[model samples]
Every structure is written in structure tokens, then in C-alpha cells.
Target: MARFEEIGTATIPGDGTRLRLLQRNDEFSIKVAGTTGELMNSRLHGSEDALATLACDRIASQPEARVLIGGLGMGFTLAAALSALPQDARVTVAELVPEVEAWNRGPLGSAAGYPLHDARASVHIGDVAELLREGKGSWDAILLDVDNGPEGMTRKENNWLYSPAGISAAQRSLSSDGVLAYWSAGPEHAFTERLRRAGLSVEPVTVRALRPGKGARHVIWLAW
Candidate 1:
């Protein structure tokens, strides 16, 4: 077996948790120092892409659609959104960890085709929740693949994102007919109910982590 080589490490800004980047042969993965396990893997990003694709497909006809992406993990979601959206569409990617963004621009860029360099994509090194609060009725679609589904695995603050208040903020951030998408490791019925309570219709989709019917099942919630 080929040993995994440690590429680099970064500290999560607020909690001081260390995130280690590792590469095994041609594959790359991100893992936290503590109990949360692997954050993401370069080879498994089907659900992430689906999160953006499903939402972008819904709003593809909207002229000059503005999309907000929460989390820039592996840039799969951003790349998929750019591919699905029209030339006039714009995408804003909010990444909490600065090192993650650096990784995407450096070692991991090729894995997702260097999405950050795209003219229509903008990278924000901050919390997506804050961005949602500030951008009122600004986004045509909001795709959130942050922190292992609706549950917060990396940061405690992420819990607010799935809460009633957070769902409300996400709802307000979208334009009428806009969609809000969420990616999770598994299903969360309570989270689905919360979205309904926020006045948005919800659709739960189970997608494989890899294409062609391979890998574990992941869930994507589409709300509008």
C-alpha cells in the first residue's frame, strides 16, 4: 500500500483545531486533528457537485443569476455550478478556513479544474452564515455543503446554520423562485422539517458519493 504523505496543515481560525492535508498517490484528503475524521476527499465529490447542479438547473433560465456557495471544499460544487449555469451567472464561494482556499489554489486546484480562477466566481474567506445575513434577496440559489451535512462537525458555530433562525436567514438571502441546497453525509428528518417551517418547500435527494452507482450514499436537500 502507498503511504499517505502529509502535504500541509492549517489551524481552524476560531476553535484552534488543526486540519491536515494528505495525499496518497494521486488522491488527496483532508482530516481534522481531533474526532471529526476526514472532512473531504478529492475522489468522492458527487454529492457536492449535485448540490450545485440541482440548484443551478432549477434557475438556469434566470438571467444573470447570482449564486452563493457555502464551503469551497475541493471546489467541486463551484466547478459544477459554473458548468451548469449560464455565462451571465455569478458565483460567490464562502470558505471559512483560509488554508482550505490556499489548498484549492495550490495542490488541489487541478482536481476541480481551478474553479477559483473562473471570471464568474468570487472567493470569500469568511463564514457563509454572515454572508447570508448581509446579502438579502441577492442570490438566485444558495448551495451549502458546509461541515458534514446539516450537523456541524468542524465548528460548533455551524450548528446555527441548520437551526430555525439560520434557515430563516437562508430563506431571506434567496430571490423569489430561488433554491437553497444542502449536502449531508446522511438524512436528517428534523432539518427537513426546519426548512418547511421556514416557509420553503424541501426535496431530499440521495446521491452516491461517486458516479456510475459506486460509493456511499449521501443526501442533498433542495429547498425553495
Candidate 2:
């Protein structure tokens, strides 16, 4: 049996909480310090990949599409988004933790095919909300995989990103016909309705951790 070895650590800005990067042989995982469950893993990124693909699919026709990803995670979502979009599409990923970005540029890079290496992909080492607030009608699509979805686990500050004002900001940050997508650890009916109350159309899609039907079920809300 291979034991997971801690390779690196990073502190969440607002909460001062730590996120640890672990590796067991060829596989990698990220977990909150002192947590048992993996926040993200190299092997179980199916839903993560789907989050970007689903959102990118909606805007595939735009040759120079501008996509903003809320979390870097393992770079799976960014890579998937890059793969689904046209060559000219621009993708920017906002990762709150600087160490996470470094991991993606280091040993953790290979797990998601070193997405940061892509020329069209860039990174913002700050809160994704900052960009949303300033980027009115700037992005064609916004995919948020931040903090375990609407019902955040790691950081309480992340709650605002799912709040009414946050949803409105995301709505306003989009170009006409822009789509917003979210990835959750589980179903969140309340969040879905919250989007509707904010005057946006929402579509909730269910996907698996490993594939279309091979692992635990997860929810992805695609709203516009």
C-alpha cells in the first residue's frame, strides 16, 4: 500500500486556513489541513472537468471567447475548458492561494496536463469576486468551482460569492448570452432557486466523480 505524502501547504487568505497537497505514487490530492476527506484529487476530477466543458460548450461558437474560472484546484477544469474552446479563446483562472498556483506550476502540474503552460490560460492570484465586480460584461462565461460550491466548507467568506449580490455581480459580469456554471459536492436545491429569484434561468446538471456514471453523483448548476 502506498501512503500519501504531504508535498506542500498553502494558507487561505481570509480564513488563514491551510490547504495541503499530497501525493501517493502517481496520484495527487488536496485537503484542508486537519481534514480527512479530500477537497480535490487527481483521480476524481470528472465533475471538475465537466464544470468547464459544460460551460464552454454553451459558448463554443465564439471564436475569441473569454472564459473566467473561479478556482484553480488541480487545473483540471482549466484544462478541460481550454480543450473545449476554440484555439483563440482566452481563459483566466482566479486562484485564491498562491501556493496552489505554484503547485500547478510544479509537481501537481502533470495531473491535469500542466494547463498553466497553455498560452491562452492565465492566472489571477486573488479572489474571483474581485474580478467579477470589476469585469462588467467582460467574460463570456464564468465557471465557479470555488469552495465546494454554494454551500462552502473551507472558507466562510466564500459564502458571499453565492449570495444574491454575488449572483447579480456574476450576472452583470457576463457578456450578452453569457453562461455561469457552478460545481458542488452534492445537490443544492436552495441555491438553484436563489438563482431564479435573482432573475436568471438555471439548469442543474448531475455528473459523476469518475465519469458519466461511475462514481459518486455531483451537481453542476448552469445559469444564465
Candidate 3:
């Protein structure tokens, strides 16, 4: 096992605290200042691989369709979605943290091969919540990996995106038969109900990053 090396450090704007990024080959982690919230390599909870799989599976059916991916997180989800879709598909990724996006297009791009910079990709440096509130439709698929899950990893305010109003906004942003998939660290029955209540046909898919070698399972909520 390789050890993590410090890549770069930055302080969250407005917030006085700082955070450091670490990398061990293709795996990466983040250490939050004055906090124990150190995200480990694409496993042990903050698994970017799992997020990618969940997002990709939901948009596999729509060729030449428009897809919106919330959160760039390591660019895993965006890259995976691009790989699953046809050449004609377009992916719009909305990321709140500009630094994360820069890290990917720079040092971390090698891990995922700079997929977000691909011709089919459009990067939105903004909040996913605001995007939802804009009432933009015509998207064939919308993948939300914004928080650690619907329950959130870092911010409690993210919980609103899992709320009834947020889900409704997501539904409105989708095409008639469009799919909406959310990646959560754990299951949330209330969120599932919210999806259905928002008029989407919902299904829960359980998956793992490693077939037999890895521990723990993650659930993906697929709503269409």
C-alpha cells in the first residue's frame, strides 16, 4: 500500500479553516482543518468509484441525451457517465467548489484521464441547488452526488436538496421519462418517499465497489 503525499492545501473561502489534499497513486483523500473528517481513498465510505457506478448506470439508456451531474467530487462520476453514454451524449456537471474542479483538470486528471475536459463535457462552477431552482428542463438524466448522500457529509444545509421541494425541482428539470439518480452513503427511506411523491417512478439499487474483496454496501436511488 502506498502512502499519501500532500498535493496542495487551501483554506475554504469565508471560512477560516483550511484543508489539505492527499494522494496515493490513483486514490485521493482530503483532511479538513480542526476536524476529523478525513475522506479516505475511493473506499471506506467516500468512495468515488461507487458514486461513478451509480451515476453511470442510471444514464445508460439514453443515447444523445442531455445529462446533468451534480458535484464533481473527483470527477469519477462525470468520467463514468461519459464512458457509459454514446458519443452524442452531453454531460453538464455542476460543482460548487472551484478548487476541486481545478485539482481534477490539473493533478488529479491522470487518475481519471481528464474526462471532464472532454468535448462532451460542460463544467458549471455553481451550486446544484440553484441550478435545480432555475426550473431548467429537457435533461434526460440527472445524477446528484452532491453530498455524502442525501444525509450529507459536510454541510447540513444540503439536506434541503433531499427534501420534497428539492426533489420537485429536480423532477421539473427532467424530461418526460428522464431518470434521476442519487448517490447516498446510506439509505434514507424518507428521501425515497420524497422522490415518489415528486412523481418519479423510484427504484433502489444496492451495489459495492469491490465484488468480494471490499466491505460494506451502498444504495443508489434510481427515480424515473
100-192, model 3: which lDDT tens digit per residue? 788888887766678877999988987888888887787888888776788765666678889888888888888876778888766778888
lDDT of each: 0.89, 0.93, 0.75
Per-prediction RMSD in angstroms? 1.3, 0.8, 2.7
- Per residue, candidate 2 scores C-alpha lDDT tens digits across 33-131 of 987998988999999989999999999998699999999999999999999999999999999999999999999999999989999999999999999
TM-scores, in order shown?
0.96, 0.98, 0.86
Ranking, lDDT, top scorer first: 2, 1, 3
What are the runs in model 3 whose C-alpha is more than 4 Å off?
11-18, 40-63, 211-213
Worst 10 residues of 3 by lDDT: 39-48
After superposition of all CA atoms, the RMSD between model 1 and the true structure is: 1.3
Give the per-residue Cα lDDT of candidate 3 at 55.
55
RMSD of 2: 0.8
By TM-score rank, best first, the candidates go 2, 1, 3
